[model samples]
Structure formats: C-alpha cells, structure tokens
Target: MNDEEARTRLLDAAEALFYAEGIQAVGMDRIRTESGIPLKRLYRLYPAKEALVTAYLERRDRRWMASLSAATRGQADPVGAVFEWLAEWFSEPDFRGCAFLNAYGELGAGPAGVLDVVRRHKAELRALLAGIAGPGREGLAEQLLLLVEGATVVAALEPGPGAAVRAREAAYVLVRADGTG
Candidate 1:
C-alpha cells in the first residue's frame, strides 16, 4: 500500500476501535494489527497514539461536514437543512455518537490540537444551527444543541428510533417556545 492508503487504513481502524472500545482500550499495537500497517509506517505517519487518534477525528470531521453540506445544498429553508442533517445522522445504521464527542470523552481535557478541532467543530455546528434558527434566538441554539447531543448519545446507548423521536419532539417544543422554528 502507498502512504495515503496506509494512512487511510490506520485512520479507519483507529476510528472504529476508538469509537467502539474507547481510546485507552485501543492501543497502538491493536491499530497496527487491525490496519495491517507496519510499525514503521504507522510511526512515520503518526509519531504518537494521540496523534493518530487526532488524525482520525480530523478525518471524521471532514467526512461529516461534507455529508451535511451535500445534504443541505440548495435547500430554501435553513431550518429544514439543519433537521435534514440530523435526520440523515439518525438514518445511519451505526451512527453511534458524534465522533467529536466520543473523542472528547476519550481525550478528556487534554491540551491537544485535536481537542481544539473538536471544540471548534461543535461551536461551528452551534453557530450554524443558530443561523438557521435566525437572529435573536441565541438561547434556541443552546437548547437545540443540547437536544441533538442528547439524541445522539441516547441513540448510541439504546440504538432505537424512540430516542430520535424524543429529540425531535423536544426540538419542536424548543422551537415553539423560542420562536425560532
């Protein structure tokens, strides 16, 4: 495999194990074994386990944003765009939790660039939601944000449609209460 192929394999392996088993449980050795990438190539690409984990997150972020953007392209209503994004997430068979949130849990409060990326991505999401929610609804963003986060976690834990339905209900109530929807 070429350098990019090896890197993709490593990230794919790391992303799955980190999400399923948590970061601490997924050591470098396991990633090497799963990815079929030699130690030398792994180390050359990512000098540390944390770096590999961080890169995995970056890959996730890009994929998620691209998917979201494509799903929402040319939608006349911004609010609908946001819901479509969430709905598509719910549609995933193995949605689990938001990769950024999972990464945050694994990394704790470590002062790494990966943490910064996670934070910034979440913040951008909030801003996007707020923009769609419209002006003078700052509180709506926070409320909807919490609901979506709750929905993702609940789905990951229970793997059911009810959690997503509940989240949508909560969102409806929030939008009604906040006058954003």
Candidate 2:
C-alpha cells in the first residue's frame, strides 16, 4: 500500500483501539496487527507511540468538531442544537464520553503533546459555544460549556440520554434567564 493509505489505516486502527480501550492499554503491535501494517513500517510512519496518539487525537478533534458543526449548522438556535446533537451522541451504543477527556484521564501527565491536544480540543469546543452564544454572552458560553462537559460525564456513567436531556433543559432555562433564549 501507499504511504498515505498505510497512514490512514494505522490511524483508523489506533483511533478505534485507543478510544475503546484507553491509550495505555493498546500497544503498537496491536495497532500493527489491527491495521495489517508491518511493524517496521508502522515505526517508520509514527516513530513513537506518542506521535501516533497525538495524531489520533488531532484527527479525532477535527472530525468531532466537523460533525458537531454540521449538526448545528443553519439552526436557529445553535446552542440548543448542540445539546440535541449531544443527546444523540450519548444514546449511541458505543458511547464512551469525551475522547479527549478520556485520553487526559488516562495519560494527562505522561505526554505534553497529548495534554496540549486535549486542551486545544476543549478550547475549540468552548470557542464554538461562544460563537453560538454570540456577543454579550461570554459568561453564558462558559456556563453552557460546563453543562456540556458535565452532561458528557454523567451520560457516560448512566446509560441513555437522560443527562443530555436534563442539561438541555437547564441550558434553555439559563438562556431564558439571561434574556437571550
């Protein structure tokens, strides 16, 4: 296979295994086996496991944000749309909370690149929320971000989309009380 194809396959395998089983739990050999890429080629491609992890997270961030943006696009109420999207995401059978948060919890202190990616992902999410909130609602954006993150954690613990539903309702109340709903 070509280098680009090999890289994509490796990343696909890495993302699946790492997100499902935590980063530290999956090794390079397993990624090689899963991706069907030779060990030597994998090493040449990634150089280090940390590089692979960082690439996985960076790609995931792009894909995740793109999905969220697509879901909320053209909506009259982007803030509400975000929660609606979260509800659907939480209801998925493979739901396992925020991948960035999961990675942080697993290896927050181990790799600087990993931690930076996590932080950047969160900051981007917050920025998206802020744009949805519009001007004079910075505080609301922060509050909404908290609700989103909290609901994600809660949804992970409890099955279904109850947390997102409750969070959505709370968000509406906050927006209404803030005179922006």
Candidate 3:
C-alpha cells in the first residue's frame, strides 16, 4: 500500500490493540503484525510507541467528539442531547468505556504525552458542554461532565440495566434546573 494507506492501517491496528488491551500491554511488533505493515515503515510513521499511543488518542478524540457534535447539532438542548449520544455509545457491541478514561487509567502517569491528550480531550468536551449550557451555567458543565464520566464507567462495568438512561435523566434535571432547557 501507499504511505497514506500504510499510515491508516498502522493507526487502525494501534487503536484496536491499545483500546482492547492496555497501551503498555501492546507492542510495536504486534502492531506491525496486525497492520501487516513492515517494521521499518511503522517506525518511520511513528518513530516511537509513545508517538503511536498519542496518535491513537488524537484520532479517537477527533472521531468521538465529531460524532457527538453531529448527533447534538442544532438541538434544542445540546446538553441533554449529549446524554442521548452517550446512551448510543454505551450500547455499542464493543463498548469498552471511554477510551480516554481507559487509557488514562493505564498510562496516564508515565507517558506525560498520553495524559496531556486525555486531559485536553476531556477539557474540550467540557467546553462543548459549557457552550451548550450557555452563560451562568458553569456548575452545570461540571455536574454534567461528572454524570457522563460516571455513567460511562458504570455502563462499561455493569451494563445490565439503566446506567445511561439514569444518567440521561439526571442530565435533564440539571439542564432544566439551570433553566437552559
């Protein structure tokens, strides 16, 4: 394949392996094998495993935020709409909690770069929620973020009943209490 295709394949393999397993548990050679990309090319694309991990997170951040944005676009209540989006994400067959949260739990301290990416992704998400919440709703943003993170973790661990549904209900209460929805 060409350079672009090779890059995509490498990233695809890295994302799957890193998310399915932890970042530390997966190796560059395994990524090479999974992607079918040669070692030399893999090194050229991502000179170090840290770089690959960062890229995996960056790509996932973009895709996740974009999907959430699209799903909530032009809605009457974006904050509530966000919870709806989360419910769908929770229901995905391969739902494995928030990728950022999982990665942070695995490699947040050592790799500084990965932690930065995770923090930035979460900050951006909070910012999005704040914008949707409008002015004077700073507390609303914090509360909704907590609800989202809690629901994601709980849903991943015990997805039997109404984790996302309950979170969604709580989100609506917060939004309406803030008089924004």
Candidate 4:
C-alpha cells in the first residue's frame, strides 16, 4: 500500500481494536495482526503504542468534528445544533462510550500526552457545548457534558435505544432550562 493508504489502514485498525478492546489491553502486535500489515510497517508508521493511541484519538476527533459540522449545518442555534449533532451518536450501532474517555479509564493514567488527548477532546466537547448553550454558562456546559457521559454509560449498560432517548430528553431539559433549548 501507498503511504496514505497504509497510514489509514493502521489508524483504522487501531480505532477498531481500541474501541472494541481496551486501549491498554491492545498491543502493537495485535494491531499489526489485525491490519494484515507487517510489524515493521506498523512501527514505521507509529513508533510507539502511545503514538498509535494518539493517532486513533485524533482520527476520532476529526470524524467527530466533521459530523458535528455537517449535522449542525443551517442550524445557527448552538443548543439545537447540539441536540441534532447527538442524533448521530445515538443512531450508531454498538456505541459503547467515548473512546478517549474509555482509553483513559482503561489505561489508568499514563504519560502527559495520553492524558493531553483526553483533556483536549473534552475541551473541544465543552467548547461545542458552550457555543450551543449561549453566554455565561460554563457550568451548564460541564453539567450537560456530564449528562451526555451519563447517557453514554447508561446506554452502554442497558443495550437499547431507550438510554439514548432518555439522554436526549435530559439534554433538552438541561439546555431549555438554560434558555438555549
């Protein structure tokens, strides 16, 4: 494969494994084995497992931002956009939890860079919330984030559409109460 395709394959493999299996539980060998690429090629792309994890998070973040941007199009209202943006997540099959958050949880803390990705992803989510939530509601954004995470957790536990529905309802109430609904 060419450079771009190879890189994409490696990242795709990492995303699948990292999401399906825990980040810490997955190793470079498995990533290589799953990708059908040789170990040497994998190393050339990612020098370390941590770097691969970072790349996985980055790929996911980019996809997330793209989805959010596309889904919220023509809806200038931030809160409304957020609710619609969430539809993508709720609609997905096998949605377990936030991959970044899950990675952090599974890894049990690591080098600064690993945690940095989690923090950065979180900040991005919060910023999206703040934009939709309107002015002077940082606390509200954080709270809404918690609600989102809670919903994700519940959905993961319950294994049905009901959990997502509940989350959307709770989110509607939360944002509406803040006058952004």
Choose the strongest candidate by TM-score.
2
Once fitted onto the true fold, the runs of candidate 1 whose alpha carbons sit more than 4 angstroms away are: 76-88
All candidates: TM-score: 0.86, 0.97, 0.94, 0.87
Candidates arranged by TM-score, highest first: 2, 3, 4, 1
Better of 2 and 4 by lDDT: 2
lDDT of 4 by residue, 1-181 (tens): 7968988888988898889878878889998988888999889888888888988898898898777766655675555556555655755775767787788887757756778888888888778767656689887888877876676677666655565566667777877787754
* Clashes per candidate (backbone, < 3 Å): 0, 0, 0, 1
Model 2 lDDT, residue 173, Cα: 92
**What lDDT tens digits, residue by residue, belong to model 1 across residues 1-181?**
7999999999999998887788888889999999999988999999998789778887888787677667656778545555656766766776777788887887778948779889988887787667657688888888878887888888777765666677777778888887644
Candidate 3 per-residue lDDT, tens place, 1-181, comes to 8999998999999999888887889999999999999999999989999899999999999999999989888997676688778888888777788889998888757788888999999999998878877788899989988998899999889753368789889888887888877
Q: How does candidate 2 score on lDDT?
A: 0.93
- Backbone clash pairs for candidate 4 read 78-132
Runs of candidate 4 with Cα error greater than 4 angstroms are: 76-81, 84-88
Highest lDDT model number: 2
Candidate achieving higher TM-score, 1 or 2: 2
Between candidates 2 and 3, name the one with more favorable lDDT: 2
Candidates 1 and 3 compared by lDDT, better number: 3
Better of 1 and 4 by TM-score: 4
- What lDDT score is found at residue 40 in candidate 2? 100
